[model samples]
Target: MLKGKPKYKAIRILEGCGFHAQMGLEVLEQRSLINTSPNGYLDMHDHIEEMGRNIACRLHPNEPNKRRRLCDKEEIEEVLVNDLGTKATRIMNLKNPSIHPATIIEKLRKMKALELLSVYDADRVSQNWVFDEDVQYFPDTLRSLHWTGYPASSLPKTFQANDLVNLEMTRSCISQLWEDGDRKVE
Candidate 1:
């Protein structure tokens, strides 16, 4: 058993390790751990199941067999809006190996308190996926959006480039940024 005072506000569960989800939850609930490192063993799967709604996960890369564990839109909404309540912020789906593009879009659309969102897929090619809703649903608090393989032909009518500090959308199908004649080039 590990001993010593818990000084870290965040923890990382190394891949293939046998860290029990309940134990991690106990430490988080009792010790006030507020964050979890990205691309590690402790992912959204653990978060949703272990009562980690208030704790912000920096990234949520898909598991090797992600299709079986993928949370539907309702579950994602429940975790972010109902469970996390006002504490939900950053949501990262970067490097997800098998998640459908629409699923990622739906997740983003439902999350309102997001400050950083990463839906980058390093392995996939552009699929020209269209979001059912407009991007305007994205919170004004959002500052970073890193979505690789974005398939839309243009950003939603509500997107304002001024609000974003870091924007990376490689392999996107955007032919134009906005419909209005005013285009801001930096």
Candidate 2:
């Protein structure tokens, strides 16, 4: 592991990812690191939470507390500055995920982390938002946005244009938006 604290550059990245140095023990370890240990999963959660907090703060600066709350099966997408094109800043949106691994893969392909935008699934999709695609390795700052108990695919897709503001959509509605290619800024 790292001796003492992480380097300045690393800290900057961590800060940008919404992680302070204090919450470094809650990260989830990948299967490779999970040799019958408890810290691994905790660490994973921390790291995922940090990423989610950062994304939420960036996307919705006005309400940091509301966005960073912990839970299960949360969903969000973050586009880097270089990828924004006309948009000056990056964009991040939280969304849920499918339970089945096959469905997860399908959703990942459709989300197009390599093409449309990058996607990270922490703790089975919605445990937290992470910059790393490898869900196996988790960092510190465990704070999951996932609170819903249902699977992403099970939720209904009913979020229509001009409906997001008025609608507190369930996982299904959000998934439907992505499935139908209907993120029209409602």
Candidate 3:
């Protein structure tokens, strides 16, 4: 689904979900399904790449909630604020996603199939974008989460993090990862 993304990064994300990336990548290479670029990124033919991305979306172009990837800004915002997500939405990439602080967790709980979530804080200044309510739950289905300016002090313990692999929070307010008596130490 990631068209021009670095291969290593995709492998790392997949590895978190118990996928044998190295083995699978090698097989793809052997079958000429993909190749390694000079920069070590995945290289594929144009038709092949186009076909791969379309297989999941060709059946539901009119339905944003049923698409495998959500990139439309308006639709992305709608899902965040309205909780109109479905299992088909596995990847969501958005810039400056704005969800009311109080409703953040409630909105997240509805995205049960989210595997990769990348939220860019391009507009909002890097500050404490936290909420009044302490978070009680975070999506356990995430394999990769890249959120700039993460607001919470500690990760919700209720977040199982069973499939979590890559967690990137730039200039976040997090002083601790989880509250294990270490939160207030510093």
Candidate 4:
């Protein structure tokens, strides 16, 4: 843990050792001690919305925070839209078991900069759901998609994002990733 005032010299020294102290001295000074461990340290410049999304994505049912009632969807959306100007690129764990899948889909469709989407159903089983809209509604910049309990029988015909690198769907009804037989898989 870093204690005391983190002056410019201290910041530089930490940086020289491959540690980042980008939060600046004023912010660091407010904390009595800063833990530099991997899980303890977080970039101050990182959007809280993004961080919350990640937390929700990685949240385990048995985690202590879950019992404390940490899920607050409205607050997360507010920070994502108001504070970060809706600039989130990676979205994960936005689905909570209690919330309906349709609502989650609607929320995802509106994210302008969303590049990575990871969703899980808390029910532990696949539910039949369909996205009736064209795949073009999804951001072309999307690179990774992980959806648990996906309800569709096949991937959207309009899904042609060239930037996509990872796709995972568990407990899904998908029979094929695309309709075009001519498309090559590399």
Off by over 4 Å in 4: 1-89, 95-97, 134-136, 179-186
The list of candidate 3 runs beyond 4 A from truth reads 1-6, 26-55, 98-105, 134-137, 179-186
Best by lDDT: 3
lDDT of each: 0.46, 0.29, 0.70, 0.49
Model 3 scores a TM of 0.71
- What's the distance in Å from true for residue 139, model 3? 1.0
| Residue 179, model 2, lDDT | 39
Question: lDDT: which is higher, 2 or 4?
Answer: 4
Per residue, candidate 3 scores C-alpha lDDT tens digits across 1-186 of 444558888789878767898899889999998888888787889888767757756777777777878766677777667667777778877766665433544566667888887776655535655554444456778888876666667666556676777888787667777767333211
lDDT of 2 at 154: 24
Task: Please provide, for model 4 over 38-131, each residue's C-alpha lDDT reduced to its tens digit, 9 standing for 90 to 100.
Answer: 5433233336445544565464433322221223455434433333324343343345445555445444444555555656665745566665
Clashes of 2: 27
Best by TM-score: 3
Tens-place lDDT per residue, model 2, 1-186, is 111223443333344445673344323223322122333211224565566556656754643223332122333222211122122222223333334333332333222211111123333534222222232211111111122322343212231233111122222213443335545442
How do the candidates rank by TM-score, highest first? Answer: 3, 4, 1, 2
- lDDT agreement of model 3 with the native: 0.70
Off by over 4 Å in 1: 1-87, 91-93, 133-136, 179-186
